[model samples]
Target: MTVYATFDSPLGELLLVGEESATAVGGTALVSLSLPGQKGAAEVRDGWRLAPEEFEEITAQLRAYFAGELTCFSIEFARGAGTDFQRRVWRAVEEIPYGRTATYGQIAERVGSAGAGVRAVGTAIGRNPLLVVRPCHRVIGADGALRGYAGGLPSKERLLGLEGALVP
Candidate 1:
């Protein structure tokens, strides 16, 4: 079954979703993360259960991260549904170390096609369901300007700042 939990953070309330009854390629994977007032914030569909115990470690890590007490996550994120290209893009984002930033062009290049797939990389980044856990906010514009974030630009900036990736 798909289980979810809500976590309160410095940024705001967050909703974390995972599928324990997954029969897909990845046995168990985090499916989506929703911020306060976001689309899935109020979702209470069938097969969805509130199971905070399932996310104990993850929530603790997130808490430590927001408190600046942790830099890396040891969570096992199950690779969920996505195209090969999208999966590649997300994997590239995962390689970005904490307190660092990379442009969409940089990610495109890292994924093996330099200048040709910036837009596609951005699209994949935009569609990332794992959010902060995947570090999508670490990707910026070419000129180092903050760009679009699914959680909103302000949240993006705050995340960057929290990671010490933003330069004032």
Candidate 2:
């Protein structure tokens, strides 16, 4: 069964989608973490259960992250959440360390994609279902420009700034 909960963060209201999982911190595996006004944001659909209690651990971790008390997330993702290629890109994104950024071309190379595949990498990043928890916001342009973010560029800047990744 699908379950969901909303979280009010410094960025805005966030929609968290997940499912029961024996190995996850909260007995749930996150499927998606979307910000307010995000593209392709998840909505509360019929047959989905609203279970705020199920997200206690997630919210606590998020609170710690926003407070700069936590750097890495221990939450688990639902199995088989994306295509193999997309999963590859997402895994590369997950490797991006906290308070640092990487270019799309770099991620493509990390995934064994040629320079020509930078655009494809950007597309895959754009379609990433898990946002902050997956750390897609840390992917920047080769020119050091903050590029497209599912949560919007302003949110991207805020996140980078919060992480001390932004240059003065």
State TM-scores per candidate.
0.89, 0.97
lDDT of 2 at 1: 79
Which candidate has the top score in lDDT?
2
For candidate 2, which ten residues in a row score worst on lDDT? 159-168
**What does candidate 1's lDDT look like per residue over 34-76, in tens digits?**
7665432446578788888878878888899999889887666
* 3-106 per-residue lDDT for model 2 (tens digits): 99999999999999999888888788899899999998989999999998889999999999999999999888888877798999999999999999999999
Backbone clashes in model 2: 0
Model 1: residues >4 Å from true position, as ranges?
A: 21-28, 37-42
- Which candidate wins on TM-score? 2
